[model samples]
Target: MDLLKRRLDIAHVIAREFLGIQEKGEQNLLECWLQEDERHRMEYEEIRQLLVAGEEAWKELEDGDLVAAACWQELQREEKRRSQWWVVWYRYASIVVLMLAVGIYYFAKQESPETIIHVETAAVTPGGGKAQLTLADGRKMQLDDTIRLTFKEVGGTDVSLEVGVVKYSGVDTADRKGAYNTLTVPRGGEFALVLADGTRIWLNSESSLKYPVAFTGNERRVEMTGEVYFEVARNAAAPFVVEVRDMDVRVLGTCFNVTAYGANVVTTLVEGSVRLNRGEEHITLSPDQQGTWNGDKFEMREVDAQSAVLWKEGIFYFENDPLEVILETMARWYDVGVFYADPELKNMHFSVKIKRYENINKILGIIAQTNRVRFEIKDRVINVYE
Candidate 1:
């Protein structure tokens, strides 16, 4: 009995820390407890795994063994041990199972729901290579598996559409003026393009890029709205400039990514260097650095360039992002409207790594396991609740 009490005391401290109820300095006690015996560390690991296991697995564990009475008693005296009482303790079958249930209960209490909603659905299809091309004469053509477009020349530029990529070859266009082409990728779609300037670009969903059929001016300039990853061709004589949202990205030769969604513009540099100009304010960004223009001002931060450009590589890599932000990305990729049934659920944080091509429901199922929220899909809308 005495040993059981001491084990419960250690369990209480570990549980509190795991649940984020204890302060950082308080971790010393748990560390000392673990170092005192190898079995202590093993026991803690077991408890941790059980806590993160599925709800059904936990119920099965509870049925296998758990003494509710003893666990309830130890939970009551949890705080009393911080001020006094020292004893020897060991793990038993009942306490082991009971501790797992207690961890779940604590997590559940932390996310108490003001309202309850149940939801789940089949996997919605993923986005694919699709877009629309508008010619200089204002003629729109759809690019898909069925529609094959072969244009010999678009205002002195040779254009070829093959598979999912569009290539525009350079030609003497000094004789021509005011001729441009625009490529628009709608929701649940993406496309690739090689401009006449030799720059390669990958366009994300809900984005558009407008460029001249051939470079002719003092600078090779393109206007874009949406998201694009660029590998600008080296041309010191005529610097490549991309006008996106409220900012202009100027590059002599570089690889970078620009996301101009809603009212904000985020430019992430992958290689070489680029200058971001918004009115008179200009900032230079190095490799692995990102510049965010939030309407009024620019904020610079160092980020993992690969992670920022993962969308082009067919992956969704979210590094400790908030739920609302993740859902916003999902909305564009899956072509769905996201609504929070409970607005408060939007603030929850998630560090997730999932393939961009995965089914929508599969992604939601993984997130729902966090126990912080649930999701429902109706038609093309996703509703999140607690």
Candidate 2:
């Protein structure tokens, strides 16, 4: 088979069929992705469609100069469908991209069940600010009520939501071993807290923080279920440990941010050093560094803390926000449903500066304005027009 030609055709098919984008012809897809503004949607679409088409046509081709744009289709199409075990073992990158590329293998074979993990830090149902505080006495406090009230004294941690910050102080830990209290932050809202250790924490929307009323044992450990930023109070003897999904974040009382949302958990260290452990894979990061726990692996890179903590500042600082990504942010903050009238809108990306108080419609409009796209808002859903 003509490998180069076949690979190009597969790429074309991926861009057009899977992603629902027609480059009008096969050759145009390569050009489009290379010059398709900055969203990189064109590239992503090309990869998706090509993978789909190649799955059917791969194995028939002979060897050639495995071009950058055409290598994946060649290998995937040529190889006979392997068991999901092999596919998973073969996967060496983040799950987001690799999972889709090796679609057949991911769900094809039956093996020992992989651990069922929850990376979602936030969950918002019909009601906004849908969170609860489980008192040590087995009493539950619903947080939707905006009126601040003293909830209960749960295990020496007086859990109270006063002016949105869940205060957990009043009671002392009595210097016991590892006794802890938990706080759950549901979707559509955020909570701040001052730990008895003097570490101030900011829990973003749809997140929870479980920590001991006082640091006990050999370490100060906290379990996380979403995103949180910490200005940790230092104690070398009691290093801070954050456990999320399958990774462990150990720090010596440094300021940092942890964002493990849905299959994507990222740990950004702002000061001092942090050791990031993903299963058996371990890597240490310094200030201004980041480690992203992809589906199957960990990716470490440097980052600007400003972009990571922009949400805490009450503004949407989207350096490059795609439509759906932007919509997720809006859905959480504005407490609304997200819908797209056209598939093309999903292909667009924006770099706009927006505030929290802006209405949903206005936010959508501003986003559309950036892309020269128009939108319609009814009820809580947004309809985009090309």
Candidate 3:
């Protein structure tokens, strides 16, 4: 308990320092703590550098902005209630505090009219449950949260759309032997589905999945691009396979997330076991393990597998990810484009947890607080600068 308190106290001190509100006593305490261990000093330096980077970025914005002045005033009021603020005490506390401090400083320092900057952009809304369903006969039907109905596929398979999910059922297995359906989730949209075999799938934005209307053989396979989370129904006799560009993930029944948006194909296992195969090279993954097939070789690593599927839960959780990677994800979900003025800024790393449904500006504001980067939205493109 004392150890935990000490860590929390250190976080508070560091946060105050980042906000430029640390008292003399807190500064002395932090200095003493820094002298106690080399690791502590290193941690402090790393966070300080990040904060400094943010400060430098803020200098790029134009002055006398109305929005910056309003934000500065609001943040000043928040600072008075700093003691009541929630302190997230964990291994990542230092990094989290750095983000908080940079954000607070970014707003707080804009109090002077000469330092304020104004930005104008159209409101960008969040993505929702929407997708395009293509039947075996190539008929396309649009699906969204508002639509609810039951329809029959060309192969006489019963397909239903209710509560944003497209489900396949009641098909004569013999008649719909090779009939296939595809769910295409476009940028700024997401969708869910239940296969005839009872496997549940959640597709992320800019993703597509092609599956059979009915299971008629010894194996069930689905071809997919982009990202998808699956909860395969248990079927010992018939194995389930997810086919990516160059690899296949085989499983009897399991819950896992597959990300195939780029050159790399990543499979994060949440429950049960999965075997990944590429040509003759194959690897098995256990729960909480992630397998990445980067065209040639496959690499495995242990991770918080559940974190990989947070998109299904309406959250964006990034852990020590680069700015470019994070923005790429945001671009897909928000259906926007990104351009960075300083390419080096793309390498800035951050850890963030934010609601997926929040306005794009709110998300950008949080990152802007870090002072590491400022964003300008024109048309539907997000321009980033250091």
Candidate 4:
């Protein structure tokens, strides 16, 4: 046999070994292949590990008929290409084997038949750019990714929406009494805004920002709830300030992220400088520094500041975050409710990085692989059990 045919035959033998249907001579052939080279042994070990890990998950599959039909189709194709039968067989075999390997690896880790409770297959789509803008006059306007238009604000400032962003220009700075506008992003939505002063802000799900139509007087200030990332415009004369509950973040020209959805307020400085003040206590943060105000006192730590703004880039980046915290974030982005049957499950920590646009199942599946917890979805609510 040719080199390619030999490799394909070896792969077929490996698949049969996993399924416990290998013929008598296949074991000796696999051993010979493993002994031929160190790389072969490593590859064989890797495939074996995947098969073992996914064994339990494979048993849970309910598509036996579909699998049998697919196998039959592959067999038919093999007869038509007798000269390349090994190649054709291995091509389809590898797909089936790898899919089984991946599914098992993700769903069967340390899982036992008695421990398997439930798994929901319902799909939940990801969030997108959507928000509502409230003018100073109490007029509400819906803004989404599809619509693009321009209009004048209450203070005669020109506001325009284009490509998922709202921009404010032609500011009447002379009118010192600037009218305010509140941008509210609901659950499963996010939006960006450019203030009249050229400052840029990105709001996360379930967030709202109240800012002036134009930066007037001696300072540029905004009050917000939930989470937001800011790129402040440089103006040494008028420093920018963000008010989040009891905390105040003051900066002249910088990029930073503030999370204030919970009792604690976290400010992560990406570049330039920001001073965080809560009543009498205050602290300044430099680039790559994070400060948290926990209602009573302030705690500062050095961290990867850029990671805090990953939401704006359509990425979910978690670093050893607790299950409760991660679920809370998912609740906002996926617009789903969460119920924990076991309180202890909330304290489980995990480090994960994934695209925000993926279906909720894929994200939850990553967690379920641990086998420490199981989840069931009912009417858009996720129930967790341990």
Candidate 5:
């Protein structure tokens, strides 16, 4: 056989063997291919990792033809690098990155009694990551394209609405009289803002923030629900305060993320210092520290702040998270409702990183790949069962 054909035959054998469907007589052929050269062993290991641990990358299969074509192109590129002596083994490792991706598609095709998908031609599209802004005067604007506007006297101040950001350039600590504007991000949407004080804010899906059009009083305060990441502008004189549920996070020029939804209130400090005021009790948090307020008390612990803010960077990071938690989060971002046929499935754990824009079905597929549970989507509702 020609080199290309030989490689193709070897790949077929390896794939079949890995799937445990190779003929009894094919074991010798697979063993010989592995032992023929050191390069073969290395390639097999790379493909094995792709099959076993490439769930994050395989998520793109939701795009159908585009994802399939991309995986094939990546595999071919890896095969081509085999002819280059100086390319090094590590360089071609990327070629096998999508090897398991192709395997997933093929595995699903065999109608393996294990993998079950209920819908045909499922196309529940992802969100576009946009939010609606309500001006201080009760005027709601859908921020889609670029536009600039000056608010007419709602707070007796001029607030500039440019693009998707609202900036109050003229600082009026004196205008404690300004109106407070609210920004609401509906389910399956996200938004960013540059506050009047130059503080930057990123709002996740199903969240809202209420802020003044201009700074006022001795402190700058904003009320938030759901989740938000903030880079507070430095103003030691006028501390920035975020009110979430029953907790008040007071900071003077700091970067932090706050998640307050349902009955949970979590504050993660990324930089600077923050004090959480829960009624009469005050708790201080330093960098890399997280505080979770459970109704009546605050619990503090050191954590990986980057993971907490991953949503702001357009990624989903789950570290051994419970299945119910994962479904709750995905429900917000995908605008779907989650129902569990077996409540015990909520205890299952998963760890994976997925892009925010990926289709919901692919994400569910990743969970289903664990083989511990199955999923069905009907009218934007996901039903899970084991």
Candidate 6:
């Protein structure tokens, strides 16, 4: 028991030194001398108890954000102190060295920028491809062209954007029959639109939206594959609906996000009531509530809506989204296929907010810090390992 207590005392000092709270001194050697004396061992126990008490004080946390920050800061301070005592206590230097190596490895990973995912067919990537839109007239419009048209389609009639969101009425489509427009958002692609009803829809990568030039009935509907963020125009006479896969969402002109990429579909409402149904399961949501489904059943709960659909604004938000969800987004945005080395790693969860422009390596580095897992980017492919 004495030996065990002595070791714990030494571990407490090393932990503090590793956290960087102590000042510069003899390093590991000084730490070794302290372990030879029983009196010093007793002092070490005292210090350990103090540290334990401090940890307990933190247990009564109120705000999660503040607690996380405080915890991280305390860890950092302790590690810094541990570093100075490391050389003095050469016996305990191994732990200090290991942590330092890990921190240094993190820095090295950051220095090496990684390529964007799956933009290329192979792991060693090339460049991404551009998206093409098929207008209702069967005309293909390459978005890369210099000729930019504004008055696209608004409120079943047509309207144009003068500048930012300035409205210019569209000409009557009475000359033609019901026309369908196929808008494809290729990998690494995104765009904004003013719907026929003055609604704004932002399309993310690997997404496609099909809509008619005008609405003929009391209900407005559009087809979607992938994901979209919408601000519906208020129309009491006609409600707006989005149909994708097995899910259909009815909205009365409010803001919401819909992710119906494949078998799973998630609809999160920001403001206004939304009626969602997947087959027989139907649920109505108030603001801040989301419906999660996968063709079989539907569930509603409160969620962080921004994190659910940040892709629409050219930002990626991860609020404890699992590896599966993150990989799905990565596959869509970077246009790559993921091969798992082990099944367990696929279930790991991470929380990070990143912009689309940052290279894959930066995000991977952030992820590696939380867990022992590491990511290696080879051209267009990323290898994840624990």
Candidate 3's C-alpha runs over 4 A off are: 1-107, 111-121
Worst 10 residues of 4 by lDDT: 55-64
CA lDDT, every model vs. true structure: 0.78, 0.63, 0.81, 0.82, 0.75, 0.64
TM-scores, one per candidate: 0.74, 0.62, 0.73, 0.71, 0.69, 0.66
**Which candidate has the top score in lDDT?**
4
Question: Among these predicted structures, which one has the highest TM-score?
Answer: 1
Model 5 pairs whose backbones collide: none
Which scores higher on TM-score, 1 or 2? 1
Give the lDDT ranking, best first: 4, 3, 1, 5, 6, 2
lDDT of 1 at 319: 84
TM-score of 3: 0.73
Off by over 4 Å in 6: 1-130, 145-147, 150-177
Candidate 4 accuracy as TM-score? 0.71
Q: How accurate is candidate 1 locally (lDDT)?
A: 0.78
Question: Where does model 1 exceed 4 Å of error?
Answer: 1-88, 91-94, 97-123, 145-149
Weakest ten-residue segment in model 2 by summed lDDT: 110-119
Candidate 3, residue 146: lDDT: 94
Worst 10 residues of 3 by lDDT: 84-93
Model 4 residue runs over 4 Å out of place are 1-122, 173-178
112-168 per-residue lDDT for model 6 (tens digits) = 343222223343321133456676668876663233456454234554432222232
lDDT, candidate 4, 228-345, per-residue tens: 9999999999999999997899999999999999989999999999999988999999999999999899999999988878989999999999999999999999998999998899
How much is 218 displaced in model 6, in angstroms? 0.9
